[model samples]
Target: MVFKCPFTMDCAGSVTSSCLVAEPLRSTGGREMLRVHFTAEDLTRIRIRAHPHPLWEVLLSLHLLQTRRGAAIFGPWRRDVRAALHPSGDILTTLAPPKGYSPDFLTPFVDSPELDDGLEVVLSTSSATLRADMTRLAEQTKLPSWAWRIAGGDAEMMRRLADRIRQYHAQALLPYAHVFKSHIREDWARRAEMAMTHGLEHVLSTLHPSIRWRAPVLEVDYPVDQDLSLDGRGLVLVPSFFCWQTSMTFADPALRPVLVYPVDPVIGWASHASATPDARSLEALLGRTRATVLRVIAEKPYLNTKQLARATGTTPSGASQHAAVLRDAGLVNTQRRNNSVVHSLSKRGAMLLDKPALQDRAGYPDIRLSNPSAG
Candidate 1:
């Protein structure tokens, strides 16, 4: 059965199309592109999320980590979180598709923008939405026994699922709350600056190296033949710290469209080797200034020499020299972006932070990662 488009007024006579799927991309040169055909309304509605959406992040984490794509970017987070999650990790894995679709109801956008409020709203998902979402999910995957039980709208099942999400958040994400929020705020600031200074087109064009802003359509690289006709319903662009490699969109064409893209350099859970002696983390190991450079790179992950210099209050040459040292030590990784190079932390660098020898006293070894939808 075809579900009516949510934006019936704007997307007149629109119906969900089979072609609306976002196929996975081989992503050569970080170049998987999705050509999002945006209408004028979408342009007006184009805005950055003020805060991270809980459902999106939680659910996306499950999907990415399960697929092992998360290992590269989320090396530190994954290693640390896994030990804490235990049996909950197994339960969480069921809800998210390692590679395909998830039901829309599982990640309902809460009425409020706040994470707590949103999670509460998620807990209170309407029966109609749950049935619809679960039914859809059922169509795609051979869901486990637990999912079949929840499809009946059982209160006990629902409560258990919600509890798992709460537990998962506390275990996996809470520890990084401050750093994650800080990175998001920084991203929002940079986006706002770009929007104000460079115009919306630049904002789209520079969204990621893989994304290309061609007039009327935002092209994303992917492996299969797929297309998303936004019609007039504006899209929600959600930046995610855990979303790796590929940008994800909602599978159900009937729901409000969303694009969950990875936040650059958002993961650097590891410590870097500093020029300073025997210090555990990059900052302490490298001395204040050098560590600041690594931190800056982690916050922005994938910056050119000039951008790095400006952010770290160092000359481009100085940033270049420090980056080289970090790279030689296998702490930082660099990629070529045309004439310039982009720098970020290597998986090895993130692991350095995870080691007991370089452990931070305050960092929590709490919570295993879980997927709420799995239950």
Candidate 2:
């Protein structure tokens, strides 16, 4: 289908009907859209976020895992994240709603960022602010037993809460947080280049499946049906690795407008899982047992946990445990099919399997045609 660039705005040159970003159309159903009306000032003020928000990603990831909405994509980190949250009790998990009111203080929009910076914002919130946030959250659903203590301005509890935030980040996010931000930068660079070359029209039209550029209005695919008028505040389009859904904005509509959208396929591919090593690399780096496991996976692609275990002479759980390590290193890629999850070599894994051959192929011959003196 052809997308027409709205003529009212200046795009210098026209855009082809083709999509510039690949993940948008695939990510959404295009059933319902957020019809966001833009004021003239909103146009100039509109921005694309250059990096992923550290706290937001953690909150979002925790939300998904608890609800199991996007659990398949998370891999073994599902278990690890829960363990990380254990120190905090059930309170941390309750803050990130799949939708509706979350305690704003806990997951505040980072007008300023950095995990500690945002946590400080949460911790430093006035008594009134904390009470208000807790009250709002309580109305939404049942909060945990200790919720009142934090809301009541218990300093010791708040200190412990901050530490919990640190622990949570370490477990769920530290492994891949920088990579997530880096991928966002990489994607934003492409969008920035496109906007520079083709103008903002191209940026909006192909922004995502859920978002559309229709002349004066910026359409977003939201859960509930409503129209949001930008009212000259403009929008911050934040690209996130952990934001698996269509897009979201700050709860406080009065706050500066922002839209948290998932990054494109490149970011998704980069952020989802890393590659696992092959037999040869394992032998050199780890041990012969690891090498043997790699060889078993290499011999057969898409081996389910049981098959992999049987082949490697280990239990299914053991095979999965090893595969998790390999997956993190950027060697193996795993997918779920029906009741089973299948694991196989990634491109990096393939290279690991045949690195010497690749090196030989890449080697260019320096042909020593007879040097006259030498001859």
Candidate 3:
């Protein structure tokens, strides 16, 4: 069964084609009925693969939708996806091609025949299931009815609610940035500096000055081993918390010192102090055994209880307890296949993990006062 919008064109430019494939729930008066079941992961995968850009995967994973409903569903999904894809630390620090590796390096990986086949299968299955669910939902609730069944205002409303929830969360975690200060040191500091510089320069070059000023400019300083000059000009070192790198830029004497800060203490202070409540919520969620279970499922959507338990360092019984929590939270759905139970993060869970932290003031400790040099 399918519910296709007549107004839209298919890939072949045919307007009559059904864009949505819905499974029939029942037949009433010789008419097939159908429910809506689109998963956030499905939409995100589609969005990521739709683009051929080398950074599409990373960027798509980081793009946070602002609708309230989207936030509620997708926030947890984003964290889980992040854990699944790059659990070591940050995605940019882990998956980023080594320095000097161009975007072309990813072409083969992205374009592999096997990869394409897998993607097609996944998308097709998810899309079909979604369509069927949407159809069923439409049939069940005829309110705000359409000529052809489709995801309606309810879906949009859910997304909006999710976004608001995430916004609140982000705001909440912005204060904990100081707690993680000790985590940054030496090489980590240098890498963070570089990442911050790269991101800052990118944003500055692309955005209007007025718009750019609206966003806080995070500055960092790294102790210099020797006097460094680029093109006979003093160099400023900037660290990126996101990219985990230190970047040096040539600038006037006044601006040079302004940009540089001791990387280790600075990053530790900034990250811990600036951590928003939402970030804390996410961290707390991810800290749970259930979140770990969902992460495993997201990584390999078909894991048995033993496999999941091994991956998460838990006993089968513990894993079951965690799974129960996730199931109750609506973060995952389980299926009994033969003798094994297969678990996967729900669409909502997948979507939740994709959003970035929301807008909040990043807290910075009085490093100047703490350090005797400023006096």
Candidate 4:
């Protein structure tokens, strides 16, 4: 049965056409669920993007920028981006609203992990596809006259759209690209370790707090009720730094199957890196040796005491002592895992690293906008 356009938040919107089944598989406590059917072949074919997908990041980050959600985790980045981004770009805001459907043509699939390549895919969207996506977008969102022109296959309009997207990235995302990469990589390391040790099932089962794996079906908490059957085609798992609260997938089923979920906000090493403390300032607050240990853990998490000692140029006993102090103070979490005590930043630890005082005193430089691989 056809339904009204779905609620939008975190990229979950209406399922138009073949993507939605006649009836939604399940709903609980007024929450919609997206059930992805997988096969053994799909499991083997599952791919974790090595880096963040540049276009997906652009789209998802736009949603966060347009809203006040995740203030604790994303507030600093949002503030920085708002200061840099041009206020005149209504086109981006129109394409990516704070809620509801965003066109699939905005983020086309690209094999190469580069922003330029993905933008090219967006530019080359077939006219029929462009019109169809825009038409569908209009059902949920009021599109402008210029948008309809682009829907009519106006090449100049399409180029303009692509240019604006690129400019938005350079202004909003480029400066903090390192933070995005580092956080996503932390997640990648965790997932990779899980797949190697506990297996892929474990990875899927724990992707997000809202996602669950039940044999062949991966259920996700969504704003709309829908079910996508992958058939023989496997799913691509895209871990997003800006995707907050829940998970999202494409509205169109015919497109390649991919699931985008939020990376854990609490264990964000990149957030700490961006807002690092000044050497002397940290030393004053935490003492020299203890300061060094905190910095080491922020840069490289999940390190054992021996590894931490080697990295910090301290003896194992000294490293243990420092870690114990941090743990006692609720700045770090030390737990025995895989037969060794591993250390990671606690939520309080991450919050302390994110303090405005540290960032201001540190004299953090502008993150150089360099061309890097995307996830």
Tens digit per residue, CA lDDT, model 1, 47-146: 5665667777778767645544445456666665674453566556766666545666666654333344565666677777777777776665678888
Worst 10 residues of 3 by lDDT: 365-374
Candidate 4: tens digits of C-alpha lDDT, residues 74-157: 776777567556553589888777666678887777655567678778888899999988897787667889999889989999
After superposition, the stretches of candidate 3 with alpha carbons farther than 4 Å from their true spots are 1-279, 285-287, 355-375
Write the number of the candidate with greater TM-score, choosing between 1 and 2. Answer: 1
lDDT of 3 at 177: 20
Worst 10 residues of 2 by lDDT: 1-10
Please report the TM-score between candidate 3 and the true structure: 0.25
Compute the lDDT of residue 121 as modeled in candidate 4.
84
**Per-prediction tally of clashes:** 20, 9, 88, 3
Q: Native-vs-model 4 lDDT?
A: 0.70
> What local lDDT does model 3 show for residue 23?
38
- Evaluate model 1: give its lDDT: 0.60
1-375, model 3: which lDDT tens digit per residue? 211111222344322212223332333334321211222222111110111111222212232211111233334543434443323222222212222111111111222212223233323333334344445434433323331222332444333322322222222211222232223223334333433455333322222121121112222221121122222221222221222122222112222121211122232343334233334365486554454465555544556787667555567898888887777787777889999997876766656654221211122211111111112
Query: Which sequence of candidate numbers ranks them by TM-score, best first?
Result: 4, 1, 2, 3
TM-score of each predicted structure versus truth: 0.62, 0.60, 0.25, 0.67
Better of 3 and 4 by lDDT: 4
Q: After the best TM-score superposition of candidate 2, give how far the Cα of residue 85 lies from its true spot, in angstroms.
A: 5.5
